[model samples]
Target: MAVKLNTPIKLVLFDVDGVMTDGTIYMAESGEFCKAFNVKDGLAIELLRAHEIKSGVISGKASPALTNRCQKLGFDIIETGCKHKLPKLEQICTNFNVTADAIAFCGDDVLDLPIMERCGLSVAPADAHQLVLEQADWVSAYKGGSGMVRDFVDTLLLSQSNIGLKEIYQPLLRKIALDDLTGVEQ
Candidate 1:
């Protein structure tokens, strides 16, 4: 079934690496791995939860950090270590008792194609790979691990109802200003 954009979406699915992070993996000599996540994205999830929309993470690689972050973010589901993400997504939809048309999927790489194709609404970050971008229903202006997820969430919220645009955009602008100042300071 095709997703109806104007309807209330029940769930949002995310890809961890490129969609959540900036598509970079940091490995230390101590065998520890890390990925940077945006504070704005976290806030977005919080706002979505407040509005009764559930979120989840689906990734091809399993990372302890990702697990910890998902827990912190209060995600409804976390499916990791799955090379084929579509089956995991299907299972998630089934478990949630929601049809595929009520779900949105965001991703940024070739591996994300299958799930993206299956989702009702598909999104890709501005810096997404060519194939991923081509398949997306929306391409965010912000890069992943920056503010892409937040951007998408805000768009969804606004589409669903009237969220004061200024109120929604102000914090993001403030954060960017702070980041710019911090960069100069460093």
Candidate 2:
């Protein structure tokens, strides 16, 4: 599909399971569910904040790992255990004082169609469900749980300005380096 980012996207919302993780749930021996998040995606969230773009996540099922990731990333909105997301999207629009057209959404399953259809720009990872891929305005070259989020953010930033990808990743590289050198999470 042809790629076109919606301009002036004030809010960007993501679906958790398939869009963030690889739609896999690993249950530890303690019965706690674990999910692996990509560091590049974390950097993408930071980049969004740096650019003054609001970011959020909506998930049907809630997990402590997901909550920690969202909190650490400073997401503007985080809705979990939400079976129906359309109403949440409406509430988000009201809370942010922006219309649906100003929102960009990334989702990877059939359940996400309602919000996807309503959002200004709909995105999906390359490994997304067939139905989702068919409808998404932009499909990332990378799969979820890889670099899809970074790809989306890179495209969004590029569409909004002349900033190069290298420029966008420079700050993240410094942070990662500092964290590695100090043995402390950044």
Candidate 3:
């Protein structure tokens, strides 16, 4: 069954490696690490914040970069180094004063299954593992860290007819070429 995006969504939870960084862990020669994040996804998160939707990140790995990124994104909850995610999910729900029916959880790996099953809506990236894709209520056409989160944000905002987003994006839409407007290159 398709999860409806028109409803008021209270919380949005994301998985770090795959959903935020294309699932790659890059280590430099000097042991400094880095991960690529999509600018569009960053902007989408900001939009979600503007609409008063609470956002968070839950990652199995603990990295300084991830922490820094989460801080920069203004995420309300950051759960890192969590191998088992169910407890973290429960804690976040309690902390937010929301139920499973009001939250959306996006994940891309088997480790994210338990929470995904419990969320109101479950999302997966296009390149997510088979199990995760199967469990997701929606699988984004765009891959993680490559505009998948942006796609999800757009879907939610458009489906809800969010006035703020409409006011911002509608003007830009009019300026784009028709092919670009449809996101299809001719």
Candidate 4:
């Protein structure tokens, strides 16, 4: 179901593990951690930025992979190693000068409940925990790490009478020739 926000969305927050990486953690023999990220999700963050809507992460766990990905995505706010999300969310609201009613938060587990309750919009992935799904104002058809973020962004923008992926991304193809295409360096 589509959720029309009472306030315009100024900021969008996401929980990292389940919401961003399908709740998977890969640990190397040397004790390093690796997490896979969807490029489409990165593009979704960019889409929010293009529309002057800030995006951020508030996650309990910390890892180098998550750090690098958030940087590459150019997130407006990044709060990792955060055990209690509600307080951090409050601080983020204060720091960003945005009220809770103007925020949209996507989460996938129980830890996300408090913040979800406070934000103007609460979104969850299709495969999210039942509790989270119940709390969500809107749910994506895609599961976490599988274009869930993209679906959320698409719906949010569309609800605002704003442009979607084709309008924002299709022009890039015209700007760069296929012959010049190369894999992303990062």
What's the distance in Å from true for residue 36, model 1? Answer: 0.9
| Tens digits of per-residue lDDT for model 2, 1-186 | 344665578889999887778888999899888888888888788888777789999988898888988998889999999989999999999989988988889999988999999999999999999999998989999898888998898898777776787787676677778879999866
Q: Count clashes in each candidate, considering only residues at least 3 apart in sequence or on different chains.
A: 0, 0, 0, 0
How do all the candidates rank in terms of TM-score, highest first? 4, 2, 1, 3
Which is the better candidate, 1 or 4, if ranked by TM-score?
Answer: 4
For each candidate, the alpha-carbon lDDT, in order, equals 0.84, 0.87, 0.83, 0.87
The window of 10 residues in a row where model 3 has the poorest summed lDDT is: 170-179
- Per-residue lDDT, model 1, residue 97, is 92
**Better model by lDDT, 3 or 4?**
4
Cα distance off (Å), candidate 3, residue 51: 0.7
Least accurate 10 contiguous residues by lDDT in model 4: 170-179
Q: Which stretches of candidate 3 lie over 4 Å from their true place?
A: 1-7, 162-165, 168-186
lDDT of 4 by residue, 1-186 (tens): 676878899999999898888888999999999998888888788778767799999998998889989998889898999988999988998998999999999999998999999999999999999999999999999999998998898889878766665776544444334426664443
lDDT of 3 at 20: 77
lDDT of 3 by residue, 1-186 (tens): 234853478899999888977888899898877888888898778778766788999889888888989898889999999999999888887877898878889999999999999988899999999999999989999898889898888777666664665675654454345648679532
| Segments in model 1 whose C-alpha atoms lie over 4 Å from true places | 1-6, 166-186
Q: Which portions of model 4 miss their true places by more than 4 Å?
A: 162-165, 168-186
Error of 2 at 138 (Å): 0.1
User: Can you give the TM-score per candidate against the true fold?
Assistant: 0.85, 0.88, 0.84, 0.89
